[model samples]
Target chain A: MAKISVYRFLSAGCNGCDVEILECLVPRYKLADLGIEVVERPEEANVLILTGGVNVKGKEELLKTYETINPPKIVIAVGNCALTKEIFDKGYPMVGPPDQIIPVNYYVPGCPPRPQAIVKAVADILGVKIEEKEDYWLAPEGFRGKHEFDREKCMGCGTCAQVCTADAIDVIDGPDKRIVRVNYGHCSFCAVCQDECPTQAIRLTREYHLVTNNRQTTMVSNEVDLLSCSVCGGTFIPEKQIDWALKRITTEKVPAYSEFSNEILSAMKICMVCRRSIKNIREAKRLLTRLSEKVRGF
Target chain B: MPETVYIGPYRPQLVEPERFELLVEGNIIIDARLELGYMHRGIEKLFTTRTYAQNIALAERICGICSGIHTLCYAQTVERLMGIDVPERAKYLRCIYMELERLHSHYLWFGILAHSLHEHEAFLKIMGERERVQDLLEYLTGNRMNYLINTIGGVRRDITPEKAEKIRRTLKELKPLSDYIMSLLDDNGAFTKKTKGVGVLPRERALDVGAVGPTLRGSGIASDIRKEDPYAAYDKLDFQVIVERDGDVRAKALVRARETYESMKIIEQALDNLPPGDIVAKPGEPKVGEEVGRTEAPRGELVYYIRSNGTNIPERVKVRTPSYANNFAILEMLKGERLENARAVIESIDPCFACTDRVTIVDAKTGRRRIIALR
Candidate 1:
């Protein structure tokens, strides 16, 4: 009677976190021995477990549920959606982060954190002994590694960043250089970068030891010097990228490519915008010549 | 005269956000009106901004329960468009994960079904078995939920001989538990009393309203994408397309329970006949074209339509999820049933709203300006 109770709500989420949360209550895990119970009624719950990000509609409902729960309540935000609001972040449905609606006291982050993470969260909130799962039973061994960077080989074309679906790879523009930063924390270890890397520069070595909280500490970055456009003198692609492209294009010989002059080679060094502008000017000149020919006929 | 009861977009017992206004006379529901768009995340619109590889992660997030199949369908669709052939070994790897995912998902649904019926012991037992499945999956693929296994060309991870042996051992351990669970479902008079003849959607109505996966299979329709289209080395595996005659909650339960056994068998076959070769075939940049990918999700048949326009990013990505078809069929199943049966009927179809509602009818504003997944 009058024990600690939990009321779990999913704002607008994928069922992953919610299912994992449900997994903790299984007979194997048995969260009830800790004197915490998942109550159906919000009024009875002291721990409100939010499994999703708060959207516009969820903001109102979350607040309503938050208010209904009694005082001295602990709001534990489970999953990345609740902590970071990444599910529909900046989408039309999202109003703000979970903290904006109701203050979150604790956070358990993952696409969906393992069930132990959730149990630990519940226990931590309840002030109980947090039992961590044995590493062998939980995290699998084999082929688990963080992304590695080869500074000499990276052309800084941002292909890794572009190909990254996890949004782990970031192409940071510096005043003098371009940086390809790979965040190990967010990396899905899908190896798409290795597959998509044009230069075979970024690779995955079997090393899973580095785990850190600081974003900088976990970041594996490579920087390259920027190249100025031949036409506009604007900061174009990286110098390494230009060199790499030149080599790749030249090596894959087209019979017509053997006739390249210095002027043509220099024209190839123009930035994409300048290249487009040059093509437009050539079109305009042809149009003017066609008009003059019409005038001559007249 | 029928009275009206607006069930929820908000309620204590409800799992997801869905508003159902029911017209009931003496707790017997006559008609139902569904109100959607609580949080349509606009995932399809976001797809155009990301590269092919990036969308795999995005697709996995579509729904937690069947996240594997989303990647499977989307990858297959893009692969189809690009004319890239998946290696035989990779196909087997893909099948292994898909089956494991199916087992995990069905276990999840079964536990929820038990909970909905207030069978707490049964729920706990089923969830325990589910945890073991999750552990095995985690062993095979690094993460538990979104394995991130499938790629546009082939799969990312390969199952080694040691891993295969462990998987076989796990399956052996799981079989008895599966048998025990099937017996419990078949024998439990209390659960049967509540579920029998409850929320019956006949064969005609199931097909008429476009029910797919286990919901259709529960109604004795043996329509499975794995057998029909045979994606991901499923053609090599010999397993029955589990179907039940009754179109009620019990039939749905039987279909899912038996389907779990079939999944375990497929995994067994896949692991035994595990091939050797490259997991992925690297293809050139996708040309301008459109293609469709269909696969059987834990709930039903999932379809992904992808269009490319010569660039790395897709031109348009439309996901027609199994839940999209199965969710609508619930409306047909809900009519003239008691108010209490709504939860059972809805859960029977396993409504994956995140996958279902991809259309954004309008737009609004968020207070934050920072983009989430954009790099």
Candidate 2:
């Protein structure tokens, strides 16, 4: 078998992916040991490895480099930016994902995919088997890897979506269900979502090998049941969210609030709009004002 | 007769997309012009669109090598705008991370410089040592490149006793290897001979051009943002600002090589006197005002100026990266340099084109820049 020559083309990114690609050459990963050479020019290369999102300038470079590479060339897009444009997609200068610019054979996903993951991609490209070492698949402790969403634990408060730096998490409030979709293709894996999660539903698990040929393989979505307004029959909030709130109310020994917890819970069944119109109801209004006072105290 | 040579829009030596046009007569370069904007993603404009929390990630992405410093500077700036006091422990943690980043960045620069000089053995050895530092960073803050430990008010992560122990142990192991590498620079080997008198940036000229970090220090300037401004735990910690007198490629290498020791020293001090408290403060809203945040990134002084509209998002954000300042002085250094030494000289300053080409409105009258699209 001939030695594999890889040509790295840097696009418009933070250069995190490039650093990881270079990191593969370190003695630990031994990209060189695997009979791979990082050639200086595209014309001298068999595989073209591109890192970063495609901006106008990067797109030009990408197309020019792709054309320069000789026949039987392989193009591997490394990092989230290359696959889905990640956080930089909204930037003014960004051209969409690199795939829209060039034909990518393999997509290595991560904010910047782990060095080992990149090594795996190159090995897979050449149809060479990787020599597994001890702790080969283990990411470091506290490693921010793939995101895990727990449906049972999720209350659909949208805190993960709100605090997401990559804008990777999207919350869709449907009639019967609140769908929270996490696109790993756009995720930076900074774990701000994990940090700000109120119910600890979102976590980055220790599974670093996120490389895929299909873009849809990177998306994980969870759906939560939404409770409808009793009067208006409109979906207001996730049913589990209300249950979590009620559980919190019951656990905390707010004597005044605990005594009238039933009344408050019953009033909470109607949506905010319906509750506004029903504010004139004597019993409900009295309970609401009392509940509001107790809420501030708690 | 003068000849023309183009280095890149794509070159292995250039990690980012950049081009160098050199006009040469025989072996010496008569004129050199650098072409940029290939790596620009309009990060400053993007900052305005994202909220303060999201902007932290944006700031980190400006330059991957010196990523932590950007977040630290941006976080400090927003904290000042909101008048939030970060916890003492968080400050120490921030200091620790900054120093570790400096070590990693310097090691990377050293490896690249070694590789460029055809010192493949040294490059591999240095990179191996760098991976250890990166491992320590990964253990401390999850990821290797963009740590993302910094938040608006304080740091998001804390260094436990085990992580602190690992940092100390790793630095202890690295000290001897780094010393050997520094000694190699001290030697009369091919590496030292090739770099000794090449790409000299005079102290006076460096000062005039407002060069920062190792690029300025290598020219014998004793100034460092950590010492002068005293941000984070630097005011509390003790470490000398390493300076070299030569102002050549070798001097710049020496400055960075020696500074790794100073960085290790600072980290040790911060760790030994680690304060006990919460790692973050309750963040407050930013006031409608303008403020600046500055810090010593691995490459040089990084400044982030911002204006708030009294909202979650900033009205405007302007970044003055170290590479942006250091880039101007390169042409001065390149004027009389040998054509072969051109790449070495440019790499000496560790110019981060990604940091330099954020946004530049060249069209004056219309103030509308054309966006090029591929067919």
Candidate 3:
């Protein structure tokens, strides 16, 4: 039987990761049953579980801890903040992520990854076989995980970015076209994007094991073409949005829109600025025709 | 032989960073001083970059155990600044989550303190029971530790009858475990003797040191922010403040246990009286102004001050956690106690010091800089 001892050093991140670690030790998970013990001194520890993003003051202590442990020591970064610093990586007092200061052997990521994830990370390091994580616990029905966009369905109106609760989504509408960029590191897993998407293009999947030493691999960028305004030369609505508008105007069951002809259907493709001017000109012609008929009758 | 022993910068086996200097004479302590910092992440500074809608996620991360209340308290502060009217149904849902948080936090503290006293079985038992609450929270909010259920005007999620039934069932099942633990704490001589009169803070000293929540109530104050300045659906819930007069470690434990009972009661009443309506009231941009918001968290009275500069993002956000005020009170409680009794007495107050370590201190007597923490 292998005997292992660990020293828990939590730095600046939220206490969520710490709680999950404790949960693993409790009756349900029974992490202790795997021949692991928590030791008080660094010299006796074979593994160091670092559960937080290193803050300014924790920097010196962390370095000392890394040094105090005898060689052949393994360091594990336990949560999303410890892995990438997430959204709280900016501004004063934050030193950096754990790996930036000390070398890390493994990382388990989540806002607070379920206790199972921690167990898996530890077991892999110990070369012990453990069952895979229970997906339901890690992500309940609505728990946000990975951001996925269907390039075929996405019109790239930038509405997903506009409605995003976090600045995780960015929409760039230039002279050319539009694209929505998804920075997974900054995402809070709120899924406001899924709710606000008109084309049902964006989705948050239940693949919650997002731990990565490098964050660049998790990002997503989807591009789409934009339509030119019928009246002006500037790029207007997304091409897909024009089709959506045409379908809506033609398919309405209401009596007011039942008589819609090809003229009205094509007019829906025009930008709002041109649509308004055309409506004014048509009304002026109708008024002139009415006045001429009245004079001819006199 | 008065010697000052320094503890931490990187405390062993603790959940966060904290430093404490104890003045000891042999096996007895003569004086005590605490230095917080060591975990400050400048979260308050990070708030300026996020809009009011996204700030709840940051506020929820303030502390792991008291995650729900931080977001609830910040949401209140932002609501006050924006003058948003919360829906009636949202108020009751908020109350349910708040009480649930208190229940889980007390259980966590009880388990950790049990471990500190070297009673490993009791520690495992209490922590095991805490999972019931965690699972319930997960079912309701889709996350376990930080619920992140609150938005500026109201809550992000609503409770259905089925989920409410589950919570009620869990509470019913937990009542017996809570009772068993409380009874054990009251009768078990092995546990009580070490905790009973080891660190006695007089009622005056407790108030003078600015202790709040169960700590102050343990010293016979009977003061609670829920009753004093009611927020959410607390005004509707019929509950009493749990207090005791002994002012010792055991008294603090008893008060928290009783508060757990009261929290259970509050949750039941709130759910029973839950009104039907919208869960959130979408807030508009906040005007340039500052407002302080208050809530009774699991530990004590939590306060949040928010300043908005006529934009979606706030100009500043400051948090004053209950652990900060109660932390100073432990120093007075530790004066003249046995050196061995230090850990139990400090743990008894549920000193979640990591959440309140914002202020920087340069101690003249010890000539050492103390940085508490920002939970």
Return the top candidate by lDDT. 2
Worst 10 residues of 1 chain B by lDDT: B355-364
Q: Write the candidate numbers in order of decreasing DockQ.
A: 2, 3, 1
* TM-score of each model, in listed order: 0.80, 0.93, 0.86
True-contact fraction in model 1 equals 0.52
What docking grade applies to model 1?
acceptable
Instruction: Name the candidate, 1 or 2, with the larger TM-score value.
Output: 2
Model 3, B28-64: lDDT tens digits are 7778888776667788888988778777878888888
Q: How many backbone clashes does candidate 1 have?
A: 2
lDDT of 2 by residue, B1-375 (tens): 666556566644336777766666766777877888778898888999999989999899888888899999999999999999999999999999989999999988888887778788888888887888887887788888788988888898888898888888999999987787788787675569889999999999999988888999999999899999989989999899989998999999999989999899999999999999999999999999999989999999999999999999999999999988988778778878986677788789987742111112123345454322110
List the DockQ of the predictions in order: 0.30, 0.61, 0.48
- Per model, state how many residue pairs clash: 2, 0, 8
Docking quality tier of candidate 2? medium
Candidate 2 or 1, higher lDDT: 2
Question: Which regions of candidate 1 deviate over 4 angstroms?
Answer: A1-3, A122-128, A131-138, A142-159, A173-298, B12-15, B187-190, B353-375
The full ranking of all candidates by TM-score, starting with the best, is: 2, 3, 1
> For each candidate, what is the lDDT?
0.74, 0.83, 0.77
True interface contacts reproduced, per candidate? 0.52, 0.76, 0.67
TM-score of 1: 0.80
